[model samples]
Target: MPATAGERPLTPAGRRVLEVASALFYERGIGQVGMELIAAEAGVTKKTVYDRFGSKEALVLAYLRARDERWRAFLDERLAAAPSPRERVLATFDALGEWLRAESARGCSMVNAVAEVPAPDHPVHRVAAEQKSWLRGLYADLIVQAGHGDAGGLADRLALLHEGAVVMFSVGAMADAPEIARDTAAALLP
Candidate 1:
């Protein structure tokens, strides 16, 4: 979790719990993992898990948010290395490709979470929606920075390609899906 003012940093045990839970949650479905398992894997008591995270739902949210922070930082570094706004826009696909091969072997965390937590009213849905919104908004900003028209429309299209590529890569077993997305997005852009 990003340290907010007045919020104490995670204790060593808390950090361990988060790390263990993160792996378990991603490797196994959320419903399959329990607090007992998390505590056992983290070498903490069940009480410690509750003391640190309050509830299972809260812990899941923290895990999701932490993953989101890491991804944003990774994409930011890739975007910064690019020379122009257009390159930066394309950089997202390159970053996604690298991310898929290096980190996201199982697929998008948000998408997976949304599938597991299917209720539209669920907090997981909100987080997944927010992540998609951020991607679309990022595309829009890059489009405008490149002095392109229809930023909103183009951003929406790019976001779809980006998302579709992930599903194709993870579920369809298309290893080159991200490159395909990049090429398709390039054709869409001015």
Candidate 2:
């Protein structure tokens, strides 16, 4: 159910279900929320939820994919606005800061999903790992473009800072965690 072949377009009700599920899944842990609550919140029947996503796992996957898409779009926009590679690398942190302040109150959704689904082989857990791995690779690519040595090492460090900031900002109640991470990452650069 994680990867449906030639997935059909979401109907309006399906869209509503996804929207509601995304919120509930992010705010509350995936294990804490159920199909019944998602359906009730979206004003759709449980059958409609099943019809749209096939199963709860699929719905969870859909929610993770949708959020990942949005975050990538946001980061892309910020990266595009930067004129240089170094600035672009920093732009990632800036984007994260803005995204955290504006949209994410509970830290990274992927991180939360991983916490909720501890089984490494689970589809949800795999998706969450993929998201984090992608971010690390992104940093590596950006650092390479910036002419940094040991892009892999520095990228790993920077990615940790970014992720740590998210958790600290949300659960640790450190309001300026992103900014602190950004400064530390900038220092690591040059």
Candidate 3:
């Protein structure tokens, strides 16, 4: 059974488990981490972790969902603060750049999760893909609002740059990938 929305309030112990799992998954890669290690890190029994999350896949879904919520909230807040469509578009780049600069930044967790789980039937992949698609749609909407004639093309170009920069940062190629993307985006904006 899935955890109910109302039951997401974490107890101290449950919070510890989530903290450990998130860190381990981000640092070590999801495929490499085991339930036992997560339990040990959280200082809880394996059963306790199981009780809260049901299974590893479910936990992975929860982790990606949390990340999706955080990024969306940040974007929404920035759009709200900006007075014009162009400012909102630029603010999106600024927010992404800030996110990229944070130490220990593992690029978009949802994208990472999808890469880890390619099986189309996997629940984690499904949730992650849905979140990613939602992000793409939101970007396309913003571009349209900004009066871009070819919003689809603009959104595709931005998505490519954004995702490419993330992969580049993940492999340690460029620390300023986001800035590069921002520059390119600013030049492209109508």
TM-score per candidate:
0.95, 0.94, 0.86
Which pairs of residues have clashing backbones in candidate 1?
A: none
In model 1, where is the ten-residue run with the lowest total lDDT? 1-10
What is each predicted model's overall lDDT from 0 to 1?
A: 0.90, 0.90, 0.77
Per-residue lDDT value at 44 in model 2 = 85
Candidate 2 off by > 4 Å? 1-6
lDDT accuracy of residue 20 in candidate 2 = 96
User: Model 1, residue 120: displacement in angstroms?
Assistant: 1.2
> What lDDT tens digits, residue by residue, belong to model 1 across residues 52-129?
888898788888888899999999999999999999999999999999988888999999999999899999899889
Tens digits of per-residue lDDT for model 3, 40-145 = 9999999989888878876777666766676778778888998888777777777777776763377777777777888878887778768767767777988989
Candidate 2, residues 9-110: lDDT per residue as tens digits? 888888889889999999888999999999999998999999889999899899998899899999999999999999999999999999999889888898
* Pairs that collide, model 3: none
Deviating ranges (above 4 Å) for candidate 3: 1-9
Off by over 4 Å in 1: 2-8
